[model samples]
Target: MEIMNNDAVRNVVNDVSDQLRRALFQAREVNAANYIHVVLDPNHPVAPFDSLHPDHLEQRVPSVKFHRSMRADFQHQPELCPLVVTLYSPGDRGYRDEELLLETVDNAVSRCASVNGSYVCGWIATTLNGEEFARHIAVSSILSHPLSGRKVLPWFEPHRLALIVDRYPSFAWSRLTNISSWWFVDMLQQLRVVSPPEVGRNNIIDARSTLLPLSGRQVSAVWDDQRRIREAKLVAMAMRKAGLSLPEFPEVTLDKVVRQAYENGLYGQQDVVFFAMNCLTLSEDWFLHPVVQAALEALAGTDELTLTDILAGHSDAVLHEIASYESAGSAPK
Candidate 1:
């Protein structure tokens, strides 16, 4: 099926908009949620039902309905409906239902894309007659991710920094903790950045293509300052928790480590993993920043350490180590 032109799409949207509104309105009245899938081709070779996981169509709520409709029948069988709207209860399932809906829709669209022709796809999320959380209807083909199977609509991926700020809660908290060790890692785990099998084929995960600024030396002062400040704050918090009396050094300190990191070319995403693995294992080289070292030391010999640990360890020893090192005018060797 070829992609519908602007006028053709507008006509299709007008035809289905009322049906969608009615379904949404009914769903709201019962305090349930619904998935409104509007696909352009009624007889597209791919079937929506086949595209989704079996569980999605199974009865998991008070009611699950699949409605299909179109203008006219092409052959003997009723012309496949261009609109397949699945109305189901979101009652008490948290984000699971939402995830399933999107995943199923995404799968369907993906299969359809493999076929010839153009098609438009869209979905909406709304509370029972109460409020609409999101209403997105875009050309589905244009909005696709690099990764094949783990697909999500836009605003769902933290692939880009701005997307991370907008969609990642941990990012906001990281600002307060000043720990950027996980920012790049989280992006990878979340599929914001796709990794081809070629890198892992050699037992090496190279992200040079996805993450920018090949090295810390390439980082701007502003970015460096922001990263350093957070790292320092996190280290200070760890020291304080380890029973060490230390002043908040958000505005100062950790410069030596940060500068060293820049000189050592430790600004890439892989550099983050390198530092984290070393810190976890307490490696001999100590490529991590002093703040990171202090943070790790604060949690030495623990199965699971939390921010609270920063206040429970041997304070005097921790304080003496930090202070003596500073007083000696030496950086960690």
Candidate 2:
């Protein structure tokens, strides 16, 4: 019941979001079957979907799994259609529907590599549309597919989209709902910076936590002082409105953030896990930065405890590296 209720509310939200997006573009709704399609020229900067033309049927070969639904067939039958979509659903009670989405999704995913949150994958129980429509995000990258002898760099991913969500919620939703190009671009930027699997997993879970409270460090929420000052003022206003004090800090450096998390038990648990595990995801061959590797070496291999331990503490100005990496993993190739 709780899940269902949430779904019902989300449906309303999605619908409202959709309506708002449409208005932003003054977009006309087209032939929406199992998915939401908007009419646009493929060359247009915002086109998100590409369809098969009824004329060139012979050259396209969608796999069997693509047959799970009419929509999948429509997308993969591959003659050439100019229609593109932002959201799609497979609509089968059976897994066949989901399978079709996954299969057909690959067809479209190439466009989503840099997306923000992976197109909000999987059914979050009770959202009627998501339940049947298997949504897949497209991404763009610079990677070469070794097997195909083709450079298969992705253009979008979900983590990339988070910033868009953070910056312009209305624009993000509208474009995601109205124009695939704009939204996909947001996703792509995130994909470019996405941490590796181990890193991503660690980023979300609190591996070292014991009595520590669950914390959500939203790097996404971090902002420049200009924004922060406004935010601080707004927070102060809200607190005054509620007869409470605003969330505060004298500064917003990395050390300040970590210390705040430790003191209030707010941000570090999951982030610590993320930092520890992220070392594995990056390319094995190191680059110029050796801060992380140096730290690990200092902590594990060498010296007496207190001497290096205190030196390595966040406050110590001894070493500097990319904010994401704490210790250098290895020597640069």
Candidate 3:
């Protein structure tokens, strides 16, 4: 891709809109070319157009909303629902801004790695000389995950998930800190391949409907459910296998009970990792941890067995036992 002259690119952007011009100008100063421009329509298509060949514009292909959320959490100027994402790719360039462009693209794709409903419309810009050349590239494939263009809205919106953090402080902190885009995306993909764990079984009544309805949290939970339940079941089964016998546990359900228990300090973050690794049939390091074995035995002794059992008790002893076990293990030994 040829680098468009600064003046020429500026003129093209300015012609599009003062907003676009200003955004690009500010971003250009930092050497970034890709951008997300939120407009009235997320589905609007930018037809392919070459300034050098303005008469030969390609057809417009409809774009889809790749991610959807209301920007209500912003302290200032919160946008309402139906925010659209417009990935702006200014043709490839070798200027100092190339790194910024590449970094922006990487960040955008990685953030949308878990998106399920989005379509991509191609955009191509080829600069020739001191003039302008741009085109709206079109692709037939649905751009569901890892959009190459910069995502301009929704995913970047601030959220109100303090309740979740409050409930699952230990789990949230550790998971958030250790999250890898590749691993998280891979987890989402794996969830899609397998059947979602049956809900409303194992005496674990689905309480999602009764819980405080938060769209943002609900959406997030839906996305990571498979990871949550898979982690929960593995830990539960490990407790049983370690000869921590108790009454029969409820059937595994991909719901808030299991999700909340794990998130709400019923288990350690590494326990989830070990559970996940075990699911892959990877290794046996989890078994060697004395703390883990002790925790399992302690858990087996509890009368309330199901995930629902744990959640029903606001600050239950089982949670304390698990937390205490993890805390003891975390200390220098």
Lowest lDDT block of 10, candidate 1: 182-191
Give per-candidate clash totals: 12, 54, 8
Q: For candidate 1, lDDT tens digit of each residue in 1-333?
A: 224466754454343444444544553454344323323333433344553422344554533444433222222554443333443435543333454444433333333223132122333333211112111211111122233322222221112232234333332222212111111112001111121122233322231222221222322332444444334334333433354433222123233343454455444333333343233233324433364456556545553554224423546665344333332334455
* Superposition-based RMSD of candidate 3 using all C-alpha atoms, in angstroms: 20.5
**What CA root-mean-square deviation does each model show from the true structure?**
20.7, 20.1, 20.5
Arranged by lDDT, best first? 1, 3, 2
Residue 206 deviation, candidate 2, in Å? 47
- lDDT value, candidate 3, whole model: 0.29
TM-scores of all candidate predictions against the true structure: 0.22, 0.24, 0.24
Q: How far in Å is the alpha carbon of 136 misplaced in model 2? A: 16
Q: How do the residues 75-159 of candidate 3 rate in per-residue lDDT, one tens digit apiece?
A: 2432222332333434534233332233222222222112222112111111111111111111101112232332122221111
Q: What is the TM-score (0 to 1) of candidate 2?
A: 0.24
| Regions more than 4 Å wrong, model 3 | 1-70, 76-99, 106-266, 281-297, 300-333
